[model samples]
Target chain A: MTIFNRLNPGNTANAAPNPQGRQTMPDNTANQATAPESKRPQAVAQPLYAAAGTGGPMTSVISKALKITGQLESTENIQVDGQIEGDVRGLSVKVGNGARVKGTVYGDEVELAGTVDGKIEAKKVVLTGTARMQGDVIHQDIRIESGAYIDGHCKPDFGKGGKASQPSLKAVAGEKTSAA
Target chain B: MPHVTHLCIIPFGVRRGLSLESETPFMFTLARTVNGKPAFARGADQDVSHLGPGLTATGLFETDGELYVYGAISGRVDAARLIIAPGGVVDGDVVAQDVRIAGRFSGRIFAPHVTIDETGNVKGRVFHTTVTVAHGARIDGRMPWRPQSYFETLKELPETYA
Candidate 1:
């Protein structure tokens, strides 16, 4: 049986340091700190593939000013930079700065740093830095940066006693999963 | 099919003709066709719950919110739905309540409702209760093959009457 595994951050590739100046883990582990780059996770020779079914926690990054007219589903991570005109379904989605999207996003965790013109569904949503949104935001936890521009309703109902804080993207990032 | 219970089928040698056992969430069943026949089936008492070939199953086929089928897969499914993306290939039939195909598929597919997109290329037979085919989509399969319903039989008369 031939098993093919994904090449992680520090694996065999032309992966330089993340532009955000974040340091990757010396070993393979999800809890390792990460740096950012020009737009998306910059691993030149690496292929972009994730586990199926965004029904879990997934992420995707739409770099550049591209456009997609279909549903984006991933189970672990999602990041959008270009433009999406459909539903974004995943566990977590991060819209980078200068990104423009016109679609509905549903997930357990979401972060926006650009412009969105649709509904946002997640357990928690954080709008930081250069975010400008115009839609409904439903989540159990929310943090909007002082400079963030949002023109929509916000709801943080994770049930009584914060029962709605089940799948936290922050937790996923902090807790260090098995994936590196 | 109300008596339908969740089943887990793993082949001993990845061979077909193995019966799947109902009542287990940890065991994932991958049906493959070898030499034009079911070839592999095994059973594991432990939870395949969090492991698959390489992919992850988020409540798509298992109970613990994970179903892993480490490689390419084909067969019948009815639960969290199966999505065949572009460049993904599946052989044989797929039966589910809802299906989204963006790849290449051959053989028969039975679903209560089916959606084939422009990138979908389906040949062989289809037995959907209701179907939606988009433009640029390719489907060379028969539609509306429910014989147990009287209304469906009436709907079938139009083709015969014409």
Candidate 2:
């Protein structure tokens, strides 16, 4: 990339196309570059491109100004900048700053930079500094950045199937075995 | 064939109007030039919602910036500017300042500036101040023209008999 390309933000030309260069982009910068610049994620990219929809390949965006009052589910990634009053299920869910969600968020990876009044269930969960989580976080791996507010519990029991999720069932099974 | 011609008989903004069907040359240019500025530039940084392909969202989506849907939404959408990309589908009412549709919309649209692309398919009423429909666009509803000032105060849509 030339010096002019360095100054101009529009240049996504892979002059130095390496895995390391994409990781250098900031979190917010990834959103900007998604549509106009490039479709590369700023960090570790997941291998779910084909799940983004084969018929029409586009990102389902919930713009910052939009407010939804019901459920949202997507096979592809969802970037939310608006307010949602219902649950959101997607492959990757990004809740932006100033955004508010009153329902649960279910995804493979969930990143919260806003206020979520409901629970978050994902394989990987990231709570940014501006995140305000008022409910539980059930995840296998979790990263809570500094300044993130949490008013609920954090459980690291996720994706272990029903055994990890069903404590009450285990108690019932134990009683049956003991009686026998 | 002209049962819908009654939609254009409002006579509210008849005196200060441009011919609706005969202005073919102007229909293609209005969406590109608004106060000598690119219409897409208005979407810069403000629009944050982009629904990519194959996704289906069913809810009430309200936004101040543009909402670009490449997949589908089966609920109400209220935005400042809404762009439905090619193959996108919206199955409910939409209220916006400016709406550019290249996809399929099947509900009432309340907007000031409405542009329908060639690949667009519309199936409901469109209340617009300035509308431009490209050729080959399939429209199955009425396009009732309104004055620009009416849209400025268009807080709610008026009830229709249908």
Q: Provide interface RMSD per model, one decimal.
A: 15.5, 6.1
* Candidate 2 lDDT, B52-121, residue by residue in tens: 7757777677554567777788877866668887778999888777788878999898877898876789
The local lDDT score (0 to 100) that residue A135 gets in candidate 1 is 88
**What DockQ class does candidate 1 belong to?**
incorrect
Q: What is the C-alpha lDDT of each candidate?
A: 0.49, 0.69
Model 1 lDDT per residue over B1-162, tens place? 221342334444432322243212111232222112221221232112222222221211212111222223444232224455554555554544345565667766655556675667888766665677765778776665553232212211122211
Mark the regions of model 2 whose C-alpha exceeds 4 Å error after superposition.
A1-58, A161-180, B1-44
Candidate 1, residue A105: the lDDT equals 70
Fold similarity of candidate 1's chain A to the true chain A, as a TM-score:
0.55
Give me the displacement of residue B10 in model 1, in angstroms.
56
